[model samples]
Target: MAVSLGVFSGMRFVAAQPHSGNLLRSVTMAVHVPRKGLGKPGRLLVTSATVSETPSSPKVRGIMKPRKISTEMQAICGVDEISRTQALKQIWAYIKENNLQDPENKKIIICDEKLKKIFAERDQVGMLEIAGLISPHFLK
Candidate 1:
């Protein structure tokens, strides 16, 4: 038996699978790739069959999970508790809002008095160092 949906007009014959794994296991997509010499790229039908290839996403955990933050962190993020991801976003927003980036290199942040409190009193901090610098501010 074949199933058809109004939207998926081209996908007329999709074999119904009882397995509760990936719903797109039977669905294949044709992609067109441009080659150096070929006028028309060869059509390839690719199907994601394994759960590992199209697994259902789980809830957020670890640093992504919300947790209580220190007073210094709260001062920057304006929240008593926040996720590591949100904290980083807020810090970056503050940096951009205050125009705190270095004149010569954009990757280096020029810390003002407010930023100095959370950033360990450093006059300058590298963009990559932001993650590590804020790790200590997240309370256990």
Candidate 2:
């Protein structure tokens, strides 16, 4: 049996198993890497049989946007200009080094006076919510 993806003209076929009446249907699609200017037309084929070898993606290029840390938070979490990802890494490291994670539930982090002030008086908060609260302290 052949299955077609309604969105695109892609088709996939499933082979029958021995002594099995049912015909398993599978759908596989091929990716097309279009050639750039001055390049020959690219070929397309199903990728269900094997993985394609692709070069590593180029590094992202952009300005290092400056993030401002709140005056109070700056005193606690020392950092220069940092992206959101880097800020999270440093915060998590600080929490772990000081054993601030809740013993019963690691998702819940116990805050000291420093964190409490940054977190707006919450004794304990979930890890996900920390991102929102801390983001305000970072100014782009």
Best by TM-score: 1
lDDT of 2 by residue, 1-140 (tens): 33333334333333322233433332344443334563456554445542233334655433234466777676566865666666677778888988999999999999988888888889999998988888677765
In model 2, state the lDDT of residue 76. Answer: 65
> Candidate 2, clashing residue pairs?
none
> What is the per-residue lDDT of model 1 for residues 1-140, given as tens digits with 9 covering 90 to 100?
23432224222223333455546444433223334465444553333322223546878899789999888878889999899999999999999998999888999999998788888999999999999988888888
Could you estimate the TM-score for every candidate? 0.62, 0.52
Model 2, residue 133: displacement in angstroms? 1.0
Candidate 1 segments exceeding 4 Å error:
1-58
The Cα local distance difference test for each model comes to 0.74, 0.65
